[model samples]
Target: MTMASIAAPARTAAGELATFCGSLRWAELDEAVRQRTRELLLDLLGVTLGGSRVESSSAPRELAQGAGDGQATLIGTRQTSSADWAALANGTAAHALELDDVTTESSLHPGVAIIPAALGLAEELDASPAAMLEAIVAGYEVTMRVGNALNPASAYARGFHPTGVAGAFGAAMAAGRLLDLDDERLTHALGIAGTLASGSLEYLSNGAWTKRLNAGWAAHAGIVAARLAGAGFTGPSTVFEGRLGALHAYTDEPYVERLVEDLGRPLQVMRVSIKPYACCRYNHGLIDCMLSLRGSFGLDDVERIRLGVLSGGALLVADPIEQKRAPANVVDAQFSAPYASAVALVYGSGSLESYSTEKLADPRVRRLMSVTDCYRDASLDAVYPRQWPAAAEVVLRDGRRLSTRVEYALGEPENPVPLDALMSKFISLAGRDDAEALADRILHVDADPSVRALGTALRSGGGST
Candidate 1:
């Protein structure tokens, strides 16, 4: 009933953020939040393993060269490095495939960026199993809370990559937990990380794989920030709301109030959605809409496709369909909504093969992709940054047009992916593996204690990328 219970966050020591994060009582946490964190972790591992099978990575392998040999496990590549570099490589690998978790509101995938930081630190610090899980949950809360305070739509519009920008601070908080820093050092790590945070949306314009590496960079920077704080360094206290800081720099209209409010209640990570498809989360709804419409029209019947989505998201997926259509590279295929939708209709499924070179160049797939006409749907666009949706309509050459609307996308928090689906998703991405066993391993992450065995199995187990 006191102010501490109400404004308890305001009284927190700027430095003890890490300890506070580390001290989270797992038993007291809502079952949903705890379970969701495990789901995310499993998903991250799957994605990282999958990314390893992709074309040569300049950054992950590049970072490994500098690491030489220390004692950190690189996901796909045969390399060893310090905990921080290992975290960076693994984070990059995890996010490389665009198969990581996504927050609908923030439009950022926090786990890919935050988990590597925590995992690396956990391995180095020899932290208890329970402590590691608790830290991950705390990291998600911190990052999501920070992102929730800002205008995510505006940030995306201006071309700042939210995952890398906000992800750094979140990774720092999680790493701080592993390091056992008091509020002072923890807060310092955050403040320092805020300045170091950065990533742009330029990759959407040009097919570049660096954005995939941003998660690792953000996560690595976070661990570095924690180490800096541990070394007795100082950082600004008002990092989030500082006059010339993050919120102000990123947007003209900043909502700073959401950052500190309900700092520890409800848990933001629980609100995150795991990606069921490899393409951008913004386009997943349209993919679903198309998938639903597939039943109505066969490839022969389909004449043209009309794709509509929240205006803000249209640019990322449906816009510039020309180059985004028959993408020459892996990253491009992942960004093309039309391509993904076409793959769904042509193949009756949207999986790794949907974007393969053979598939991308397939005459039928290209023809289907060519007909995808995209425009902004006012109905869905009205929601803006609140809750996003995509609309689709497929017209057969026979003049029959089928339309479907998705109020909430499959992967969005509102219509979250079932835990079983997440596990199945992991296997799908981790390469054809025993999905049932993989899911069980993730479900019992704590019971097995050190995930070294599971990690080892997941790294080498999958058959396909």
Candidate 2:
């Protein structure tokens, strides 16, 4: 079939989005948005370096190592591979630590999927830093917009991971822009991406590694889609609003208008939240509540711990009470509200070390987890996907009830994590003595003539497991 035959009617959603992605320029971006993009890039790269040596990241890294040499860099290692393979390896590593940046309304990790693809492709094309940054912004716009329309709660219920699904579109846009595809080709890239989108929630059942792979695969598929489109491949233009489109296929109830609502007035990158704790974004507010009550009572003084949770996130963090209470491994613990709360109370912190195997087996943590109960709170859900508020009550052994609520968790846009704190996080993850210097380079990356030097620097710095 001809490209025109498969194209949607005039001014289709995909067409409009493609026009925006194609026309976006670095000079048109607000300074704040540009800075935020830089910060996010720094955050994602740090996380990738930290997670590069993880057991879950090993397979993809090995695969990339043997995928044949090219210009793209495999983050945290002195290796080069094809752009798609490098994106897969780096994306997997970014998500492995569960510390990647996440969006509020969309409820997905955008940086994990978009940054890797943008960075890899930019390096391969020898694209300027400004071009790459513009691509990154375009990618975030498409990913978050599609995610918003999916109604994250509904998508999660259907056992679909929004990041993997929406991320494919975002990656394609970023890659297509970097590849200098025209508006028509960019539309086809999105259409092709719609068919490639996929990510299942089955990993929740056994703490499997597929969760990390979702982000990797999304990035890989995006580059492939863009490349195919640039090579004159055609895809349906009604990829978003059609009867059999992504909205209908992946979600029970999708807010279709959200796909193009308020097109980039403020930019989606500003809405992204950097993760303070190394776990599910759903559990961050709960952890905040737990930490706030930590100094108030001794572990033994607590009779029962009741947590107010968002109904939408209940399945990922609260449901299957037994499993949540007794997380089998790091992956399970990362998604369990009970485990996150208990660990925060016992350890007085919820850092990556808090989720280690040793901490998972701690009798004190286990005892505390048994007493913690997560219940859906309408009050908390009212402003969800926008605020993510949480509440917790401690019923003491002496019948005293102490309660507290968190309107905004640290690292959120409203309650932003300080630059010093963000830098500390980056240093800890980058695991190199020159991490601060590297971060400086990343922040000013837009001035660089090309991303090739950045890749060389990343390889030289390396990263810790």
Candidate 3:
């Protein structure tokens, strides 16, 4: 077949998305969608604070600190930097703990990439809080839509990190909106992002910190791409559906129509899940199952643990079974189903505290991990990318098998975390006495004239009530 015969309609997908991003207004958002956006922002901010001091964030934070001063606040710090640099530091920190908001169908952490880029540019431009929220909504919509189109399973099969690859486009849309780029320029921004979008699953090989860098780099590249677009730079308009476009290049299976399907009827922000656990989203359901079963049996009575994982996510959290059972660090533990199960069964919870160095060396946890076996279950994969169901079966020393299955993890929209619980989580992660007040400010940011005060309040070692 000729190129023309197989080529997608020129610019259709990118054009539609650019038009949506360029024209999306705060006034168009209903209170529910707006509230969801605010909640996601609060969650992102809390996670950023919680992860700012992590080893993975150290290099990026230092680079941002030394990149020269600008108007943007480096989140979780009493410092300022250029918009892109600030985005780099804040995005990396937001994802460091794996607690950022994630999507069901998209299978990517939208807020980590979108919120940091939007916040930094919004601060630099002195934009209204409403504008910032709108930019974030636009970013989430684009990111999730692109992720859905990429067929996350196929992307993972190719050893690509969907969060980093799809996140760049989302960040560009948010940044470009903040820069007041029109539809054409926003389209160019997406095209520019296409070249910059990248993330390798190779981080899984050795528990590398590069996985955390994916979010930061996506945010940085997005700001740079938008800035380049705003400076009259030109890029291909058919960046999504073209033969060599993102959808084709990133995955073997591309649901291209998903990009424009039901464009903003309900808004993608409403579909996001806040993570209660500090690990891969794939392990959350299994942890929930383990937590539910822990009280029913004594730890010493367990002979073996069998986990049901979705085929799509198996590569992420279950495969290389031996490696999953022996996590070397926090990053490894975060992606290991066996480790997640072991910790939840041993500690009866999967909080950030459960993934520490002490837990990594805990003999009880290691023993449980040794007995854990993760297998792909067709039942779990049947509704995956929509519902991340999981199951766990424990064999007792007396030959009794105790089994439990979870339809939705605690933080999923279907099994949503209560507002008070979310607040408690924010307080715990932010580690601040005034976290409640800061959360309130974040929730009602749309009423504020500018993001300056809100940005200041998000900084560490300062901005206390």
The number of the candidate with the highest lDDT is 2
TM-score, every prediction: 0.90, 0.98, 0.96
Give the clash count for model 1: 9
Q: Count the backbone clashes (under 3 Å) in each candidate.
A: 9, 0, 0
Q: Which portions of model 1 show Cα errors greater than 4 Å?
A: 1-23, 56-59, 77-79, 431-439, 449-465
- Badly placed stretches (over 4 Å) of model 3 are 1-11, 463-465
The lDDT of each candidate is: 0.75, 0.91, 0.89
Please give the ranking of all candidate structures by lDDT, highest first, separated by commas: 2, 3, 1
Q: How well does candidate 2 match the true structure, expressed as C-alpha RMSD?
A: 1.3
The numbered model that scores best in TM-score is 2
Better of 2 and 3 by TM-score: 2
* lDDT (tens digit, per residue) of candidate 2 on 320-377: 9999999999999999998998999999888988989999999989988999898988
TM-score-superior candidate, 1 or 3? 3
Q: List model 3 lDDT by residue over 433-457, tens digit each.
A: 7888888888888778898768777
**Residue pairs in steric clash, candidate 2?**
none
Candidate 2 Cα outliers beyond 4 Å, as residue runs: 1-8, 463-465
TM-score (C-alpha, index-matched) for candidate 3: 0.96
